[model samples]
Target chain A: SQTIHQWPATLVQPVGSPLSLECTVEGTSNPNLYWYRQAAGRGLQLLFYSVGIGQISSEVPQNLSASRPQDRQFILSSKKLLLSDSGFYLCAWSPRQGVTDTQYFGPGTRLTVL
Target chain B: AQSVAQPEDQVNVAEGNPLTVKCTYSVSGNPYLFWYVQYPNRGLQFLLKYITGDNLVKGSYGFEAEFNKSQTSFHLKKPSALVSDSALYFCAVRDGRGTNAGKSTFGDGTTLTVKP
Candidate 1:
């Protein structure tokens, strides 16, 4: 059984501060990883996705960036956080190749930029 | 490119009644659709998916979705609604392209409220 872990379940940061969120998957190798953000009472917005190490595709241009340093380790970072950057960050993984590739998500992290 | 549309923002239904959350998608090739559920302050959970085969796909917690190619819709349905079923539901779609594309487009999401 594969599982995803995201750290800093909750964080409160002042505006203009740096941000770092980590995500890792166990029991699976070289899986596809993704980063998503959701505002309160709104839908999810895809930020970035990685198919392999050192490969990252950003969807919407924002104050955030994602990097897959290891096969199963993905990190989301920002030099300075904006007030709008505050939201729930989610990390998800899916099989590399399959007909129906469904994503499995982690517990997620809540970030509040005050 | 693919896109999904969840027409309703919120659905209100009484417990024990049949519930339906509408979803429609647009894709160039064959569409691989999925349904996910999320609780407050939690991540999205995979409920079910429709790749190929039966139009109706059953998923966790007795939730099901029917895929209609003609209508370009994949609506999530449940026989009987439960108060516990109150949460947010999302519809997603993937375009048929690379072996492991890894990018999925999602809809705005629908909020399901099952009242007792």
Candidate 2:
């Protein structure tokens, strides 16, 4: 079975500080990875998605960026964090083939920018 | 562009009663619909999906969804509601065509509160 891991589970950072969140998937190769943010009332918003290594498509223009360093490793980073950047970040993975593939989500990281 | 709409922001249901969370979708080509449940302080869990064939799809925790192509709706339903079922539900849709066909558009989400 495939499993997605993310850390740190919870984070607290001061404004303008750098941010880095890591996501890694085990038991799967060449999977489609995605980054999503869930905010109060706003729901789940897609931030970025990567099809392969070094290939990323951003859905929203923001301070955050995503990178796929290895086939199973994805990282979300920001040079500087904003107050609005605080939210529950989720990492998901889906099969490369099959149109009906369903995404599997990680435990998620709750970030609070003070 | 693909989009999903969850009309109700929140739904209240008593335990043991039938529950329904509405969802509608719009997409360019054939739409692949999915339902996910999110508990407090947790990530979203895949509940069910409607690919093709049966209109009624059964999923985890005894939950089901009915897909109506003409209505463009995939409503999640459960015959008996439980207090543990209180959580946020989301509906997502993805186009069956194009290179980025795996990309999905999610709804704003609906909060389901099952009262004891």
Candidate 3:
């Protein structure tokens, strides 16, 4: 069975600080990875998605960026964080690039920028 | 562009009563719909999906969803609600055209509260 793992389950960062969140998937190769943010009282917002190593597509433009350093490793980073950057971050993995494929999510990281 | 809409902000039901959470979607091609549940301070868990074939899809925890193509709706249902079932439900849809590589759009989510 495949499992997705995201680290720093809860984070508290001061304003203008750097941010890094990692996600890794085990038991699957070449899986589609995605990063999503859920603001307070809002739905999930797709931040970035990676198809392969060094390939990333960002949905909404902001201070955030994503990188696929390895086939099963994805990282979300920011040089300087903003107060608006605080939200619940989720990492998900899907089998392949087909509509029939279902996505499995990780435990998620809750970030609070003060 | 693809999008999903969960009309109800919140739903309340007794433990023994049936529960329904409404969902509707808009996509250019045939829609692949899915239902997910999120518990307090937890990640979203996949419940079920409707790709094709049967309109009625059964999922985890004795929950089911009926896909109405004409209505463009897929409503999640449970025959008998359990207090443990109380959580946030989300509906998502992906276009079947394979244009976006299985990229999915999600709804605002509906909160289900089952009283004991």
Candidate 4:
């Protein structure tokens, strides 16, 4: 069975500080990775998705960016964080071949920018 | 582009009563619909999906959804509601014939609250 892991289950950051969140999937190779953010009382917003290494697609242009450094490793980073950047960050993976495959989500990271 | 609409922002149901969370979708070609449940401050969990063949799809925790092509709806249903079923629910859609078939568009989400 495949498992997805996310680091820093919770984080508190000051404004203008740098941000980094990591996600990795074990037992799967060349999977499609995605980054999503959910604000309080709001729906999820897709931030980035990568079909392969070094290939990232931005669903929304914002202060945050994503990178797939390795086949199973994806990282979300920001040079300077904003108050609006505070939210629950989620990482998801889906099979590359299945068109209707469901996405598996990680435990998620809660970031609070003060 | 594919889009999903969850008309109700919140639904209230009593325990042991039948429950329904409505969802509708739009797409150019065939539509692949999905239902997910999210607990407080937790990630979304897949409940069920409608790919093809079956109009009614069963999923985890006694949840089910009926896919209606004519109505363009995939409404989540349960025979008997439980207080534990209170959570956030989301509907998603994917374009089956589009180039970005892997991409799914989600609705704003509906909050389901089952009273004890």
Instruction: Kindly report which residue stretches of model 1 are placed more than 4 angstroms away from their true locations once superposed.
Output: B98-100
Q: Per-residue error at B33 for model 1, in Å?
A: 0.4
Interface Cα RMSD for all candidates?
Answer: 1.4, 1.0, 1.1, 0.9
* Residue-wise C-alpha lDDT for candidate 3, range B11-73, written one tens digit per residue: 999999999999999888889999999998788999999999999999999999999999999
In each prediction, how many residue pairs overlap at the backbone (N, C-alpha, C within less than 3 A)? Answer: 0, 0, 0, 0
Encode model 4's per-residue lDDT on B43-103: one tens digit a residue: 8899999999979999999999999999999999999999999999999998988676888
Cα displacement (angstroms), candidate 4, residue A57, comes to 0.7
Clashing residue pairs, candidate 4? none
Candidate 4 global TM-score: 0.98
Question: Whole-model Cα lDDT per candidate?
Answer: 0.92, 0.94, 0.93, 0.93
Each candidate's fnat: 0.65, 0.68, 0.82, 0.75
Flag clash pairs in model 3: none
Candidate no. 2 TM-score: 0.98
- Candidate ranking (lDDT, best to worst): 2, 4, 3, 1
- Give model 1's clash tally: 0
Candidate 2: where is the Cα deviation over 4 Å? none
- DockQ score of the complex predicted as candidate 4: 0.82
